[model samples]
Target: RVFEAMLLVGISFSPLAGDLVTLVAPQVAKAASLVFLLGAGALFLWEINAAGRWVWPTTIGLGLDIVVGTMALLATAGMDGGIASLLLINLAAGGVLLSLPKAFFFAGIAVGLQYLEHLLSLAWFGTAERSLSEVSLFAVGYLAVTGLSQLLRQEVSQRQQLVEQRESDVESLSQLNDLIIRRMKSGVLVIDAQGRIQRINEAAWSLLGNPSPTRKDLTEISPELWRRMQQWRSSGRGDYTPTALVERGTEVVPRFVAVPQSPHHSAIVFLEDSSLLTRQAEQLTLSSLGRLSASIAHEVRNPLAAISHAAQLLAESDSVAAADLRLLEIIRGQCLRMNAIVENILQLSRREQSKPELVNLRRWVVEFVDEFRTVQPLGGDELRALAPETAINVVFDADQLQQVVWNLAKNALRYGRLPEAPARISVVARRLPETGQAVLEVLDRGPGIAEKLRPHVFDPFFTTNEFGTGLGLYIARQLCEANQATLELVSVAGGGACFRIAFNAQPETLRGDKLPEP
Candidate 1:
């Protein structure tokens, strides 16, 4: 429109175009000015009415451009006029607003109109020879402009789509990363160079004692941790020892790692529970012990067997004196103790995979007690089975359960006897109504374990008795765990020790059989 207005003003002034307007036919020149004015007025009206829509405006605007260009060319009488190139602008606009086929359509129309104006000039005024070559050259130029414009527009569209897709991918990846970090078991804390907390996960927040710590400095939370972190950072070593943060009786192991490629000087601090570290260390020790036990049984069993045979031979010899016989007995007892230790270690090393089966506790306990009384006659009536009137079913390895019960029963018979009541060990089997779990308890009348020794009772090689191998209870507990049971010592009412074996009860393990009424 601005170009059209400038052309109209130039033709009106007659001086800007080197007085070419005056040299041309006055009526043709006036007609060209009217066309320019009308085209500019239509464009202004189109823009005002089609404020938001562009398809119709673009189509009409391009049409007006072609008409004005053709009229200007005719006014100057064909090739003599320099207005032929003005058709290129209309074709370029069509290429930008429409598809390739539509832009080509406009290009075809402009070329045909140019040729028509040339033919009209030749017929109306006795002009020179018609130049079909000039018309062909102009057609090629118009098509070239339209093709280049469309190519540039397509390239811009493709770049914009690529940018949007990359942005969406980046956003999705960021959200996934944040979700993983938040749910991770290990505590993660991001700290800046200024020693302030930038971000902390739930685990880290709980490890910090759940303080309302928004952008709080590390020193304010724990001076010891801050001091250790600063020392680690200054040391410039990748492998620094973890430091302990002991606050309010809870200990956490803190490790610092520098975030690589971070513009701001920042570090990621990992806080792990002390108990979790201890469990990991314990697992490693158990693995090593399992290997060591295999070697010990092979190397020591043969020598131990020979020593026991020699002790038996010496005891049977009639030439041995009475005092010598006492020494022989002592040697024999020592040999037996050593054999028990070896057997226990071998059992730990070669533990069989647990095969669980549902057992009726009441009926099973009755049969077990009868068998135990035959083996251990000294307990006599002291060992009794106390079970619920109704049968309670529990899942466990029958052989493992037997070993565990025998160990607990033997311990109770040895240390659970009182001067007044010599036989008071009882095996009680019942279901805990509240938790729906099966419990087997060995209750004793003897003095209970001391508070200080209770924690170590289930530890291997932990025993108070001089003659004990100290592996019975530990092995028993380990076997119980393999069968998904827990063995813990609880205080019995009115003074005595009660070792409780709680079995995990599943719905499928429950038996429908009820005990017959007696």
Candidate 2:
């Protein structure tokens, strides 16, 4: 579009370079000005429609160029260098965007118009000296520009194709390597549409009784797995059945799922030993967890309450010695800790509906810290809560937020302290500048978690400390997800762990989500 505008501007201004009546015939100049106006309107239309849709506009534009070129030649008696240069620029620019055949065709039309203009000037105008040599030279110049533009276009196209091919090759190699590494524990077999194996992980090879190199096809190694794969392709159902692929070999369960977005009818077959798991069957039991809490209360909490009641009754006796009171206090403290552990276990088992409310985070954090200080016995541990003065609001369940924050603060006081040093922990509330989401962080000045242990921190029943039940961080994360928020262990600059809770708020709340009941 810019090139076209330049051509139009040059054409419109060329007559003004000298006295209009002396340099160009008045009648011819008026006709050319009308043509130039139409050309300007076409440029705007092409721009509004997007210049890439190039058929009608280019035709109208080039046709106007021919008209103006002819008018200039005849009006100036074939001595208008300025108007001829504008025509040459339009042709050269068109050649880059147009096909080779179209470029040559337009160039031919332009050259022919120039020659015809010279003849008209001599026969009708009879104004001044003119020659055919100048027209011949312009004709040669137009053809040369068309050929050069085509060469440059081809060179750019080849370079782009080469770069794209290299990227595809690199991506393919990376995917193949990642596939092998991630599937090493569980067997993976990728079979192409041609019924030949494309890849087989080490675990897959071992499950097939270490087949020879000649066993390339799926049918050659395990006919049962091959049969099941074909059944999945026909039925689109991946179910499990245990079968010994080789007689007197390991009993393996074969499941097949389609490789997504594969060009061919490729499938990935996962071979798991039957002894490993019945993972799908256990999912049903997890949803009926209200029964679990009832049973724990009956079997464990009943005895725990009796013990706690007995300790309180024993401490009330007037004859109990001062030294014996310390012993009784230890017993009472152990009972409380045990009850807290049982409560955590019960909390992890139940699910209840979440009621989200808009929370003023800055006010909530300060009030929550004050309440925590009254209940939890923090011995020589410095706990501070801070937030910005501006209120940061988020939609979350108030009780569930309390539970999640309590667990994080408890873990910080328990394990976040350095050896032979008092624990210093902070609960911070702020609104993130980039996302405008409310964030709450529990930070501690302690040895940070090891890199290798980071991935399994949220896994059920995973813990480094022998005394821990390992349900604190896991339950906290679950509660956050119920509120449409993320709980992650964000790395801090100084040597400490920062567990960040980043909330995702809506105009109201996230509905239809249920967290575990207490």
Candidate 3:
């Protein structure tokens, strides 16, 4: 539409004869302006669908305006058609369409064209000798146009920098806000004015049972949450008290707090997993305090002592043959093994200063197993890891590293027994590329840990067995921290448990650097 109008106006104004009869090309110019106004409105509607691609239409419009202005300038060559003002219009149009650099270039072109036309007209029509004031007037106009164009360019450049800085700051702030929410014990959720959930945190996911609600609609995703939002909106309250939500087909209760506040009128919701976290922390603390030997001494110690005394008497008797004496020696050795466990409990209770150093876990575990096998027989039940061919060093205490692996293997062997199936344990080690961390996993097949005990399984003094001291896991956890690593008991499906130890093998600062790309 703008192209058609500009073409018509340029053709209508091509002849200079009309200026002799009239001061202005009033009807034709109005027609051209009307087309621009209407076309601009229509373009806005099309631009919405085009989104970021609207620059093309704007460029075409500005180009048409320039062509029309050029034709008008040539048409009024014999007289001033107030076309200089139209050059300013073209300058503004170009600036709006193409951006600062292109805008400045177009502004310079417009000024040059106007200046050239004025000079050529003065030379052709014998106006050069008319007056010094007229010549100075033309010079001042050219200078003013150039100065204004440069000023606009500088302003545009500064505005661009300011916009870029604002965008960068917003991104940084958004990430910081997300980190704070995730680390916070309280769960927070932000919703837009329409009541749609815009943001959620880790605690919120756990409380909501990792609700996999689609982002399509609020009511469909979580009906209970949808209803609470409606209630908060209707009540027009600043903050809503915590409300219990009974999970579908389950007795689990979730508490939620809703706050309604927004310029667009959005609501924010928060959830607290009060029961789960409390129970988990309590169990962890108790398990950390539990001692294994303290639980088993009354039941196993007396029977073990009787077996040791009998083995000693039988070994001393001359009537017992050498072959029979071998059985007595085995009995005494087994009894001594039980006594050594009590000593292990005492050592665990004593707070020892951690001595940290670079430890090669592969060599340490291998040496411990080799030395252990020289004194005691480990049958087919023993498991061996395929160590990495290359050495991977991690900062840790040598003795503590030995104890952590030993306690974990012994725990797995003791409880991983099977009645009808063969007992098997797996020891595996792998280096993670993302964080440059080393992971060691020990898996066993036995009865899986109960849901009630799972959370507190590592706490001291907490044990399922009557003969457990619970100190083993407690000491293991302490040793892991002393070695700058984390030890966690992860429940395995089907049966048994897996103990995973994660240690830093290399220094890293960026979280993205620690995450492997999919």
Candidate 4:
């Protein structure tokens, strides 16, 4: 539009143009041409100041161009002065700003104005018939330009919309990918070609032992792992062997893979904790064992019961020798032990869904200790209950929690008693302020567990004592987990073992009802 305005300004100032205009109307020709030039200049300045707002300027500018061009053509006696084609600018502007139908409408207006100018010139100045042919040709050119410009504008608009839609989709996909990566259990790290960390997820940051903010060098983190990564990259192999990176006694197994079709030559590294992998494997094994135990328990319990019945019948007989009776008693004991093992296995296999309720931890622990002391032949001072100052409520199944506490207390009494100290077991219940979880600790002054054996303490059927069932801690931990709690053997500051059960202190609404104090 600005270029068209500048061209018209030059044409109005030309000496040849002045002579042609003088030959036409002569009275109002120069005045109309000057007004047209000034109008075009004003339109150009309006467009320049319009900035990003093109719709209004384009619409008003097209209207002004058509009106001024018609006036100029009329002043110069129509197409005889050759200014009729200037109206095409209005058609082009309309096509770019408005719709195709509007562009054709403006073209029709321009053609009609030229025809009007032709008729006026013929009436006043009796201009030659050659101007009619020029008017017809200009109308045809106007229609063609309007049609082509509108088609091009429509195509560009469609392409722009498609590009915008694609960009929006890409942004949404990128955000979703980031969310999944952040929440993933396995740690993720994006490394650049220069071996610098471009991005690291929360899990990856934790797996890295949460190194200080200043530490960015992979070599500084783990030189052995960095060397292995470098070797794998340089080897140009399709696959790299997984390696473990140990930091501060925690092992993280890292697997690296190149980013597919990446131009930046980057790679994504996945880090998984070794302990987590072991736990998952153990869970899978337990799942299989649970399925197998159902079948095995039925088969083993029948024979074990028959043996126990036969042993009881034989014991009643007085004809047996003393040595043979002792042997039979041993057999009976073994049979009972085997039957107990089958019963425990069956119990473990038949895991019931947890039905949690809110219980006052302090009162529950005190009552449980009182009941336990009454049932067992222990001194009053041997077992004691220590409650928190304030009432702490936790969500758990009362029966399951009671069984877990009993097992833990029994283990504490058995292995926690030291020769130097008197036999004493303390069941302490308190709420941890930092984590907001209720903690129940069954502690005794026995020799603490060796650090080497702590990891396998919760394993099923693992025992250090010959007469131990070994499933007590395992069953306690399993029950705790089912109730969304944890059972761990934490080493006490003093020389003793502490079996801590941490309960999730969910609100009353989540656990149904809060039980009254016992």
TM-score of each: 0.54, 0.40, 0.54, 0.73
Q: State which candidate has the highest lDDT.
A: 1
lDDT of 1: 0.78
Pairs clashing within candidate 1:
none
Clashes of each: 0, 3, 12, 1
lDDT by candidate, in order shown? 0.78, 0.77, 0.62, 0.77
Among all windows of 10 consecutive residues in model 3, the one with the lowest summed lDDT is 509-518
Query: Candidate 1 vs candidate 2: which has greater TM-score?
Result: 1
Model 1 Cα shift for residue 34 (angstroms): 22
Model 2, 1-518: lDDT tens digits are 34544543454456563443243465666566666766767676775787468755666676677677667666653346556767887787677767788878888898888788777777776743456787688788888877887787678768879999999999999998877656676778888766688878888888888989677887877787778888888888855878888878778888887888998879888888775554334334533553565466558998999999998999999988989999999889888877866777776665577788777788888888888888998889889999987777778889999999998998888889899998899999997788777799999999989999897787655788756766678778878988899899989988888999998876354455432211
RMSD of each: 10.0, 17.2, 10.3, 5.6
lDDT of 3 by residue, 1-518 (tens): 44544544454555653544232344545455556556655765676788778567766655555545544444343334345455555555556546656565555555555556556546665543224454346445544654575577668778999999999999999999889999876667776657667778876655555667565355655667667667666775423434444354222233334444556565566665556556578657644543444456546767888889888987888899878877787778768866766665667656598766655556655666676556545576766664576665566667777778778877777787677555476666667678767877778887756778878877755677655656688778878876678899886776888888888534333223332211
After TM-score superposition, the amount by which residue 397's alpha carbon in candidate 4 deviates from its true location, in angstroms, is 6.8
What does candidate 1's lDDT look like per residue over 359-462, in tens digits?
77898889999999888886344788999888787888888899999999999988887776685888999887898789999999888888899988987778
The digit string of per-residue lDDT tens for model 4 on 319-428 reads: 98888998898989888777777888888887789888877888988899889887876754389899867887788899999999998887877787777666688999
Model 2 stretches with alpha carbons more than 4 Å out: 1-294, 310-333, 347-351, 366-391, 419-422, 430-438, 450-471, 508-518
* Candidate 4: segments with Cα more than 4 A from true spot: 12-53, 76-86, 99-154, 212-216, 236-249, 259-264, 285-294, 314-336, 352-406, 409-447, 464-467, 479-486, 501-518
- Strongest candidate by TM-score: 4
